[model samples]
Target: MTNTALTGVIPPVCTPLTPSYEVDTGSLTRLVDHLVAGGVDALFLLGSTSEVAFLPDRHRKVVLDTVVGHVAGQVPVLAGVIDMTTPRVLDHVDTAVAAGVDAIVATAPFYARTHPAEIRAHFRAIAARAGRPLYAYDLPVSVHTKLGTDLVLDLAAEGVLAGVKDSSGDDGGLRAVILGRRERADIADFSVLTGSELTVDSALWMGASGVVPGLGNVDPHGYVRLVRAARAGDWAAARAEQERLFHLFELVTVGGTRMGGSSSALGAFKAALHLRGVIDHPTTAPPQIPLDEDETARVGKYLAAGGLI
Candidate 1:
């Protein structure tokens, strides 16, 4: 049950990991506190930014338990129930609901060809059994299925989706959902959030309910400030904050040429967190390379430039 309407800057909280790739509970709790202190409206755990796709079942449970326990009820916690299909995702949803997350986020089935009708059915099935508010995670890049704008609106109208986290990077589709919510009285309460850190200001201007910025993990204060600026109709301040965040976002590319996007981007975040003393180690899960010393130094430079260090 979503007790509060999801809004503002809800950082996809990073999962702090030990050198052995275990969940670092102390660091995770501290990171949660950091986000709360930075004034985030809510917390999103086990999302892509949290390395949810790479986490084992045990690790995912530990992460959920740790964040939900630490946060108590300070903010709504959204847990990502990412998997290949309905049955797999249902298992995750059951676990997340048992772990006490306020909501569950699920993407379209991947690793298997699926029709648009199938995708719609997938969400409806999951929503019926999730036992909590379900947010559609529209990430075509990973899921290989672009959720059509009309489809999203229809689902919103049907109440199968409480909200949508638009990470598809399709501005037109995002705007359609945002405007559709306003024009359609039936979907007025449906939340439309964007996970695109690059276009947060524009997304808000387009009537997006909030942001799910991955960069917010390293600097929650920056995202909080940006959201407040946008909400207050201070475009100048909002643009300035967004630009500063854009500059800081360059750190994601510091691990250039040697790593995949996930490794580079997530590594940069962990590196920044370590540089900022938010975590003990900057290591990521296995098979994902850790940023070298120079790459880590570059992360520090970005943090310094952003006044975070």
Candidate 2:
């Protein structure tokens, strides 16, 4: 495959499982097709949205292969290769590359508190073997290790690092990444993506390339429109659209749902997708609890009110 830098809206796609807990490849394909039809730039299959850690190795490969086959080279596919160890991450990168992925989206090791040198080593090792571009997924909130702007810019300077998925939710870090490019005209094309739905519009306005929002699982069109409009400099339209999705973002993020718990934002996102008929089922992998009836109902009300369902 040719080397392609990941840019624009990349949906960290939610895994669509059957009620019986089997991988629903059909539903997964349909969701990818829907996103592509709606104009998403890439599909981040098997990432946080797909519960990468919870999935068995076999299941992970199956999901990646399925998405690659479905996409059939119409657009780029960034396989998420997040793991605690460098060797394992490199192996996953090889697997994804073997499966015909265009790029890899990797996060810093979780619970390990790795230093910048280790993080840089991990990414550099993977990029060397994969022969593809890499999107640094700097999600300090999800994974404990933080890939600060200085290290991120350094990696990008080395030329293998394509860009960063700046989910740090730190406006300060986001601003630093944006301004780094402005100050250095040579690397301005390097992307800084927003991981939070709330900051999608602002991130774009501040020179971010795109977003990797979870709520895009329910309303891919709206998220896509927000990014496109922001890129087009239509601030009024972008803000209005962002406001429309803000409630749903809040509802899903309530109770610190992104972290491990019974009330998972991941589960909520899959449930919302299932309700919208974009996917067949909404079951999360083990250890991630499903939304109970009351919770699902509350979310459904918000989605319905938002015309998401």
Candidate 3:
């Protein structure tokens, strides 16, 4: 990894929107302030948690510029240049680089069924011109393609990738990437961050560089504390905190049969933020059902138990 490699609790920030579906600049700024005050090491914008797939290009630009300018070098900002293919992703890459982000994150090609070599070519094309550190976002659930460890290691060895955020839900795969990075002295600084919030204690114990939990948007301080405890080798404390967060994560299921998993999870997050006074409203982008009063109350129950209230 380069000197600019991001580490620690870098939360994938939620995009707070107005009821009319425009970017709520004030609420968005307040959300940035909330994360910074929560002791987050950095911020990740336009990721899955930010409703990146649902947002229009203009809205995406607004979010990238707003958060980056508001942060003003307080913490390293990572922009997710996610799209269907390399060309579209490069467009976002150009925009993000112009906006002055610290890093760029992209995933393997999707929607058109790309081969492994094509995925390699996709990342190589981005790295060659990104003008910033590049991290692979291994999220098989959304993109339908899993970036193999060999592919990642090959790219890292060639300096095309600085780090990887392992959200593949494959613990063995995550370990292999971390171990692969450690095995090579030349790439010893390569970072291996995990997006699995519920198993962060174990991921940290296995030597993950940091975490990028979506739940961090709701309770960033708790994740910071968990990381500190793990760093101090307080495994017991880390486990306790992880379990507490696991309980809080239950709020994601509050939407029940009424909505999809994305709606449930994102809705609960925004709802908790709203109940905590971080944003003006719990509104998601669109089509993702917004949680009603009863569902939001269920989210509050988890927040209260997690002591985030």
Candidate 4:
């Protein structure tokens, strides 16, 4: 079990894939090295940015093994066990533990309508079975169920959750969790991390323990500087850094006219990585369109504007 709270910039890393959609172990290792060298606090694999829902079982395992082996315990590796049900998620948890992950992140059951009680039960079941720490992933956009503040607090109070990753973009709800933990003496060390890359500075100002910015995969150094500034109470510096990142985030909308948010954002990240020579290819998983030449050029422009190119 992890004794330390997960605090600081932990990017939901994008999985590098070959032309045949195989996990490119060499490129993935280089990506990990880039983030570690950028001074990120941890690495989150197989999360939304990783195309977890689209990756096959074999591909997921390969990614886990490759990243775990490459990282070599230099920083905490949090793996996402994303599945539609408990048994399936447990299977992933088993595989991730076997691959030497420090913790597991799971979302509310998707593709099936589930009640709040069921959501609570789902987390409890995982916590009871998982050998490592489990963090609740509140991604209503994908799971179709928002993890309520009360439910999260209840789980924390009962020791069923080690932390929460709030991607709901609900600052009110995020603040509730942060204040809830602070007011409760029963819940000790419950980490509250935000996945809103655009509002990282505000989230940190609201007392979030950390952030899981997908944009960090493209510019890890910027996020690191933002986190350091926030922690040191340099709000002006943090705001400046975050504003720069927000401008860089415009790359996600470069191809929005022809693709969904995931495709555009993930594609932009991979493209930026490829342009930087951190990865071999900018290919994303299937069913998601890759950025065209014009779109990729837009990404390059944004990188140059951010001084990342």
Candidate 5:
């Protein structure tokens, strides 16, 4: 939408750190190089998977700089705009642009729950001021705010909204945005990216340009296979692979997790990456309880059993 350019398997990279919780810049560079060479279409740094909310501003800048420096135009880099306040978000845009990021991915402010009118105004203000296109990140499970179709359509109509990464986990919600484009030609260029690995094939079948799957962080090659199969309309093969992927999501999202009410999908994912030597340590931010020795062993066993590690 709005003449924006974004598509394909853009993984929200995890912020790898050392055992002492220090940001591992070396490992980060290596990870970026690894993904880029592995055939990923784009890279998203400081996103939720990257734990940007808990990461300090200095570390955030360092991570962004590391990615931009390593990518060197090999592929487009999307800097995560995690700031909750409008002014702060705009400031992030300026900073990311300075760091050489091609675009930005942002969501509604957490705790504010801004309405459709307010949401439209918020994005419009940012898009007007931002130098690059904004990917409207709709992740209600994390921020508790959903970007409604009306608001998305309105922003596209105003030429301020870019494409949307609908991680709302609702097919109807994602379809609403696609169908809305049918009634309004202004949003005809609006791209819809399904955020789930289970629906990657179906989403593409329905007209999504690409996906931003979390599992891609652990198994980029596997997701690539699914994308190829889906794009080729090989339902028989895609469905079989999707079933295995569904198991992986369930295991990480629901099994072997605790700390709070939520499951430890992030930690589990990080652990898998570490096992693969993609990251140095699976150090999650504070207040996010890491898997203890027993829990870590359990998670490792589960991953090995699933062939994800």
Candidate 6:
């Protein structure tokens, strides 16, 4: 892969599942078409929004092959090599690469406590083996270790990383990475993408290259509009659209009281997709509770208000 940094709206594509909790390839194709039609620049598969951790290895492979074949180079596809440690993640990297992904996003080693040095080594090892451009996924919420700005910038300087996805929810920390990248001339192409969906305008203002919004699955055009408005320097329009999406994002909380955060958010996203006729059903992975009728109806209202349904 070229050192060119990935930019623009790259949505974390959702996986469409059948009632039996299997990959609904037909619905998955429709969902991909929905996103491409809405003007996304790239597609991120097997990320958190895709319920990657819950999926079996074969299912993950199915998703990669399906999307890569369906896309046919229309947009670059980025796959997540998310796992507990370097070795396991390398297996995923090999799979993603063989399946023809353009880039691979990985999180720091998790499930066991690791020092900063160990984390750095983990990434260095992956970069040495991945054979594709590697982007660090800084999701402290799951990884349990905040990837500090210095660590990220240092790795970028060493060419061990191509970019970073700042989903840590610390805008202050994220701003530091953006500013740090700007200060360095050698790694100028180091892409600083924000996973903080609601604050994309602010992230862009801080010099972020793009976004990896999960909400982009439900409303890809809205995020594309947000990015366009920001690029055009229409801050007011960007702010207005962001606020509207913020309201639409309320759908994620409908089932919050009954299930975990991940379950609720993923369910709401799938429910909205099903209501919009993009997917076949709203069945989340096993152990993750599915939304009942009332909860799904709340998702419908949000989509309707957002003019999606």
Best by lDDT: 4
Tens-digit lDDT string for candidate 3 (208-252):
989999999999999999999999999999999999999899999
**Can you list the residue pairs that collide in candidate 2?**
none
- In Å, residue 49's CA in model 1 sits off its true spot by 0.7
Which stretch of 10 consecutive residues in model 5 shows the poorest summed lDDT?
A: 254-263
The per-residue C-alpha lDDT of model 4 at residue 60 equals: 95
Better of 2 and 6 by TM-score: 6
Error of 3 at 238 (Å): 0.8
Clashes of 3: 0
Candidate with the larger TM-score of 2 and 5:
2
- Residues 1-309, candidate 6: write the lDDT tens digits: 465648899999899888888999999999999999999999999999999999899999999999999999999999999999888999999999899999999999999999999999999998888777889999999989999888999999999999999899999999999889888886668989999778998899888999999999999999999999999999999999999999999999989678999999999999999998899889899899889999999899999898986
Enumerate residue pairs that collide in model 4.
none
Pick by lDDT: 2 or 5, better one = 2
Q: What is the C-alpha RMSD of each candidate to the true structure, in Å?
A: 1.1, 2.3, 1.1, 0.9, 2.3, 1.0
Residue pairs with backbone overlap in model 1: none
lDDT of candidate 5 over 130-232, digit per residue (tens): 7667778999988888788888888877767667888899898888887886678666567677888778878877777788877778777767777788777
Give the Å error, residue 168, model 3: 0.5
Off by over 4 Å in 5: 1-5, 253-257, 261-263, 305-309
- Provide the lDDT at 95 for model 5: 79
Quote model 2's TM-score.
Answer: 0.93
RMSD of 4: 0.9
